[model samples]
Structures are given as structure tokens and as C-alpha cells.
Target chain A: MNKQLVNIKNVTIGYQSKKVLDSVNMQVNKTDFIGVIGPNGGGKTTLIKSILGLIPIWEGSIDVNIRKSKIGYLPQFNPFDKAFPISVEEVILSGLSGKKHLFKRVNKTDKEHTEVLMKQAGIIHLRSKAIGQLSGGQIQRTLLCRALISKPELLILDEPSTFVDSQFEGELFEWLAELNKQIAIIMVSHDIGTISSHVKTIACVNGHLHYHKSNKITAEQLAHYECPIQIITHGEVPHQVLATHKH
Target chain B: MDFFKGIFEYTFINHALIASLFSSVICGILGSYIVSKRMVFISGGITHASFGGIGMAFYLGLPPFVGAAVFAVLSAFGIEWISKKGNVRNDSSIGILWSLGMAIGIIFIYITPGFTPNLMSYLFGSILTVSTGELVFMGILALVIALFFILFYHPILFVSFDENFAKAQKAPVRLINYSLMLLIALGIVINIRVAGIILVMSMLTLPQNTANLFSNNFKQIILYSILISFAGTMAGLAGSFWLGIPSGASIIFTLTLIFFMGKVLKILIERLKRKQKQFLPVK
Candidate 1:
């Protein structure tokens, strides 16, 4: 039996007395690939933030079995000062900083490991380049390498493909699929059809959470959970699946 | 060169030069963080808030630096607190404290009975009149900054770059942030004697921006900023000596000039690289 990685029970999350998520429960196993989908303000990010302990719970409990460093998080791309004077290699090498001593510098082993991860991510050539000079795809790839460098058992990615082009987005999903084989994954994205093919389970978070056992979630089921977004499916029909009005 | 040799013989000139070196080193190291973290506004707030302390010191017949340090540290923590716990936005809080401190300084200076000391020096610096005590204070601060950067280089980098990741790593993110704010406050307080209240913000930003044009490595930026800051200070000091102008204004002008030159140079190099690429045979 696979070990339980996260057991979130009867949890409620909010900000300043306003509740964003209520009565959310989830169980993540050792090898589970969970795709979290919902409309923009439907508490998907709030749920993930609660799990990462970035937000405080108003009620109930969330117990993460793994240590903090064992869980890697890749936040959505936000534009910080690009000319802030940091190299791609240094940015990725910072991933191992959690494991090293606070007072110690990045040791030789850290550099070697960063090198290996850079090579794997196909960014070894851009290792010495400034982060400001990198393309969007290169920055995303560099961030992914940073996220994976510490060998996290559970990786949490927030809209990992929002900044990349479609070609690189496909490759990123493929890379995440490969990484999922060894580690549990929680990917939060608005692209439903894209994640449906990759994740083992589907979680719809809209104030409350609706957990589907498989990735194939129907429009009726999504509406039953009160999630308002339309899911577009590929194939012969290629039609938008809309929720039927009950009233 | 002859001007420097002639000035180097005087004891007060030597003190001024040493003070400039120490201030440049600390500013280079701490300035990198301030610029990268975009805390220039906070530094400015602290610099202005320190004026209150200087006024209080004048009113009470105490050393101005002591009053400035106390008020600066309090305002630094106050700004952090107000932004985090209260409803005031960070920038709004900064603006409030900035003007309030200056107002208090003006009031206290007005109330003092004796003939008011030359406030112009404090307002725009009198580097030529730097005392040994101020030099010692800056020296200690420079040493402290160097040790902090050396010992906690990676952790501080992680904290500065991606704070969420640092928190996940269980790094003391809050401690680092608060400590850095305090350091910025102290740094601004000590630097007041060099660039004074009006021009110290440039001292904290220009060298870092100039170094950023050449390299992005944090260590390289610090080293380069220190060198650049020292060179600018020397040149400005000499300029002020020859022109009979205020050292603080001259120093800031020199640094700003360097910043523009660096920008132009970067554009030229980019254009040159494009020309080279275009001239090459088609692949």
C-alpha cells in the first residue's frame, strides 16, 4: 500500500473573516497525480495554499506527512525585477539551499547536482546567462529545474503553463507526466482538457471540493459540484461541454 | 593625482577618505539587497524619519547620530508593523512617516533656544568635517554587514529571490526580513553624514544599478558596486574640493552621471552585437 502523503480533513480556509474554501477534505497518496481545476476565485489556489500552510485554516485540520523540504512548490510566474542581477545557474542552485546549512555557501556537491538538473532540463548552455535574458520557455524550464532539484516527493505546481507557448506547454506537461511517475503531483490549472489526460484524479474546488476518482469528469458532475467553467474536450466532436441549467 | 597626493597629507582629509571607503563598502553590500528587493522607498522613509532623531538630539543637547539611529530603527519597524498589521498600505505609511518626521525635526529645531547650528551640513552633508567617531561607527557597521553576507549568503539569496520557497525550506523568512529592514535603517542612519538626508537614496541605488549592467551574479554586483561607489566618492570629493561645492551633492551627481553612462554603453554594446550578427554569413 502506498503511504498517505496528505490528509486534509474538514478544512475551511479564509482571509480576514471571509471564507474562500469550506469543508474541504482530501487524501493524497505516495504516487497520486491530482489535477485541481475550478474557476478563478473558486478557492483552488486557496485550497493549495491551505495545504502548503501558506494560509491559515479557519476550521478543521490539514496534516502533511512529509517534511517541508520534501514538498516543492512552483508558484505562478509573476514579473519581478528581471534585471535584479541573478544568473540562471544561481537561481536553480538556490533550490538546494533548503538542505544546506544556513551559514554555509553552496558547496561543490550542490553545484554538481545543479549541473545535472540543468543538463536534464536542456538549460545547461544557458547556465551562465542572466535570468533577464532568458526566453519565457527558458525561464519556465529553469523554474521547473529549481522546483525539482531538491528531489521533492510531492511537487505542487500552480498554473505551470500560463506563461509558455503551446509547443512548450505540451512538452512541460509531458515532463510533468514523467516526473509524476516517481513523485506525487498536484497541478493547479484552468485548462481542464489538458490536465484530464495527465492526472490520475480530478479535484474540483469551488468553496467546497468535489473529488472524482478518475480524470474523466462530466459536465453534469462538475455542475453538481457547482463549478461554472466550461470544459472543452478534444476528438471528433470537439465541442464545449456546458453545464445544463436546472432552474 | 597631484590633488589627491596634496589632500592625502592632511589628517581631516585622511579621515574623510577612510569614512568614504567604509561607507562605500557597507552601501555596496546592503545597497544590493535594497535595490534587488525594491526597498529603495523604505530606505528613503527611514532616511527622512531619522531627521526627527537629529532634531530631538539638538533639542536635548545630545549627539545627533544617536537620536537619528533610534528614530530610524523605530520608524523602520513601525513601517513594517503598520503595513503588515494595520490597514495602511506600505507606500502610504511610508509617505506619512516621511513627512511627519521632517515636520517634527523642523519644530524641534525651531524650539531650541541657542543659535541654531548650521543645518545645511546635516541636510546636504559635510564630508570634510567627518569625525573619527563617525568613522568608527561606519567601520563597525561595514564589518557587521560583511559577516552577515558571508555567513548567510545562500539563505539570504533564497529569501530575497523567492520567499515562498525559502519558507518551504523552513528558512527563517520573517527573521531575515525584519533583520534586513533593521540593517537598512542603520545603514541609512550612518550614511547620512556622507550623502546627508537628501541624497543618500542615490548612494544606495546607483552603484547597484551600474554593476547590474555588467553582471547578474550577486557577489559580483557587490564587488563591482563597492569599486564603483569608491571611485565615484573619490572623484566627487575631489570635485567638491576643487569647485568649493557641497560634497554630498557632488557625490550624488557623479553617481548619477555614471548610471547614465552605463546605460548608454549597454545600448552601444547591444547595437554592436546586432551589427556583428547581421554581418555574419547566412547560416
Candidate 2:
């Protein structure tokens, strides 16, 4: 039996006037690679937001044992005006936001470590250059480095593979696979096929939680989602299976 | 040399020169924050709209600077209140408030009594007439802006990049936002004194855009802005002395030339990089 990491029980999440998620229950263990998949506006992002303490839960309780330093997050909506006057290195260094002291100067050791993380994320070459000059893949990788700066134990990636070319998606998944050994991952993705191999479990969310074990994602579950699942399966004709659910 | 010696005969010219440098420095520093916040448009709205305060000050026989600062600060808060529509959708509301504030300012000026001749300078800039007291006040405000940037550097950076994430980090996000508005208010006040309300946005925007050429970090942004502003100020002062131009207009023109130079430099650098990449072997 593995240690439970996150406990969510009967939680209802909504804004001041509207309820988006109702009575959700989920439990994540140390070794569980959970994928929270759901349709758009089915409270997928809202659930993730609640975990990040971004939204108020109208009812129930969500107890996350991890500290901010221990839980890394890759935000879905990267609204940074690309033309912002900042460097790639500076932006990546912001990942250390979780662990940094407000009044203290970022010391030599912090810089050295940030450089190491940038190298690990494979963006060391673009370090000194402006962030605006980087490609979409490079920016995503940079944000990942920022998330990894804390060396977190639990990683929450909100559609990390979105907006990138398919050719590099495999490589990005491979990199994520390597990181999965050291940390539990809860990826909220619509690319079901890509993430199926990397994650250990799937939490099919449509304002609720459906937990599953194993990497094999069934076409039925994919169809059942009514929106999108965050896994890739090894079974069936891939394109036909996807095309069947397109409607 | 003989032609130059003739210009310094008037004490006001010397005062104008000193005042120009002081005003440029203040605007350069505060404007860096504004541009980085992407709030120049908002600040411009504040500056033009702040004229209502000046008219009110004229009506009450008080210093226009005091009224302008008060009204601009109040308006800044109003803008923030209006921005509560999820931060992303409140842009239209901000746009409406911005124009309405300016309209109110213009109306106040129209209704105010007496033939105020130099109000045009306040509408634009009258660098020559800026007094010693105003210069000192600008210095103090500049110092405050600099101090705020230094002391709250991390929180400010965090909020600017990702406000929601910053809030989740349990950072003083609200305080940071309020502080940002306070800084902007100070910026509007200082800008009015230096460039007058009319050309204040020029002082707020031009130097910062030019500075973005070389700066990557926050401190570098401040340094580059000051340097760029100083260069523009010097050129404008020289132009005013030699070409018999209004110091304010000359400053704005010099700043524009500096921004143009920055664009050229950026283009040249990109071309050079492309050339290097083309000539190199692919891995």
C-alpha cells in the first residue's frame, strides 16, 4: 500500500453564483500517475484550479498534504505577453518562486542551480536571449524548468503538451517519463494518446472523478468522457478509434 | 562658444536646463514600471484625465500638483475597481472609464474661471517655468518610486508575470497590486510636473521602450531607462538651446529619435544572428 498524497472528498467548487463541480471525490497515492481528463467547461481546469487554491470550493473538503515547495504546477493559461521585456533565464528563474524569500537577494548558488535546471529542461542555449524570441515548444519547456526549479515531489501539469508540434511531443513525453520516477504526476491533458504511456492512472473528470489503474486506456472510457481523456492507448486502430469519437 | 555664452544670460534658461534633467530622470524611472506593467495607455488616461484636478485646484486657489495627484490616485483606484471583471474581461470597462475621466477633466477646465494663459503648458509642458520647489518634489517622488521597486522587487515581479499564480503562492498579491497602483499614481504626479499633463505619456513610454532593447531584468530595465532618458534629455536641451525650440517638444522629439534608433538596432542584431545561423553547420 502506498502513502496517500492528496485526499479530495465531497468537494463542490464554483464561483460566487454558479456551481461548476459538485461532490467530487478523489485520492492520489505517492506512486499514482493520475490524469484528470474531461470535456471543456466540464470543470477540468476548475478542479485543477481548486487544487492550486485558485478557486473557492462551495462545499466539501480537499486536503493536499504537500507544501507549495513540494507541489509543482504548470499553468494552462500562459498569458504572459510574449513581448514582455524579460529574458528566458529570468522567466525560468521564476519557477523558484515557491521557495524564495521575499526580501532576500537571489544569491550566486540560486543562479547556478537555475542554470542547471535550464540545462535539464534543454533550454540552456536560449538562456540569455529574450523570451519573445523563443518558439512555442521552447516556451513550454522553459515553464517546465520553472516548475521543476523546486525539485517538487508532486507535479501538476495542465495540458503541458498543448500548442506544440506533434514531432516533439514524443520527446517531451519521454522527458516527462524520466521525471515520473522521482515524482507523482497529475497531468490534465486532452491529448489522451500521448500521455497514456507516461501516467500510471487516469481520473476521468466531468465535474466528478472516475479512477482507473494501468496505462491501457479503453475506447469505451474515451467515448464515455463526452469530451476528452488525457491518455494514449496501445489498443485498436488509433486514428479510427479517435475519429469515431470526433463527433 | 560666444553664441552659447549669450544663452545663459537669463537665469530661467539655467533653471529650465536643471529642471529638464530632473524631470526626465523622474519620468524615466517611474515610466519603466508603467511600461513593464503594460499600463502606459492607462497612465496616459490618468494623465489627461487628471486635468480636472488642476481646474479644481485653480478654482480653490491651491497647488494644481496636489489636486492632480489626488484626482489621479482616486482615478487609479477607480480603474482597479473597474478591473475586477476577472482581470481579462475588464479591458472594455477600463477603456470607458479612461475616456470618461478625460472628458470630465476637460469639462472642469472649461468651467473654471479666469484667463489662465500658461494652462497650455500644463496641457503640454512648460519646463522653463518649473520652480525649485517642484524640482525638489520630483526628486523626493523619484526616490520613493525607486525605493518601492527595490523593497518589493520580488512580489512586484511575481505579480506582474502571473497575478493568479502569485496569489496562489500566498504572496502579498493584493498589497503588491495596491502598491503598483500607488507607484503609478506617483508616476502620474511626477510626470505632470516634469512633462506637464499633455506630453507626460511620452516621458512615460518612449524611454522605457528604448530601454527594453538592452534590459532583461528589472534592475537593468531601470538603469537602461535612466540612461536612455538622460541621453534624450541632453539632446533635447541642446536642441532647445541651439534650435530655439520649446524644451518640452524637443524632449519628446529626442525621445522619439531614441526609440527609432532602438528599432534599427534590434533589426540589425536579428539580421546578424540570422547570418550567423545560416553560415554555421547544422547539428
What 10-residue stretch in candidate 1 chain B is worst by lDDT? B1-10
lDDT of each residue in B187-234, candidate 1, tens digit only: 889899899999999999999999988788899999999999999998
**lDDT (10s digit) by residue, model 2, range B1-283:** 5335744787666676676666666676677777887888778767766777777787677888888888888877777767763454456655765677667666766777877556777776777777878777777777787787777666577677777666655656676777678778767776665567777788888988888876666667778888788788767867876888777788889999989989999999999999999999878
Residue B97 CA displacement from its true place in model 1, Å: 0.9
Deviating ranges (above 4 Å) for candidate 2:
A1-4, A15-19, A163-182, A225-233, A236-247, B1-11, B85-91, B106-113, B213-219, B261-283
Residue pairs with backbone atoms closer than 3 Å in model 1 (clashes)? none
Per-residue CA lDDT of model 1 for A1-247, tens digit only, reads: 8999999999988888888988888999988999999888989888877877777898999999998777878877644567766789988877776644576677788889889988877889999998889997788888888888788999999888876788777777788888888889999988887888889998888887878777876666665766654655654433344444332
TM-score of each: 0.93, 0.87
- lDDT by residue for model 2 (A17-122), tens: 7778878888877756887777778887898888878887888898988776577788997887776666777776666555355676667887898889777767
The worst-scoring run of ten residues by lDDT in candidate 1 chain A lies at A238-247
Query: Cα lDDT of all candidates, in order?
Result: 0.85, 0.75
Model 2 chain B worst lDDT window (10 residues): B85-94
Q: Model 2, residue A103: what's the lDDT? A: 73
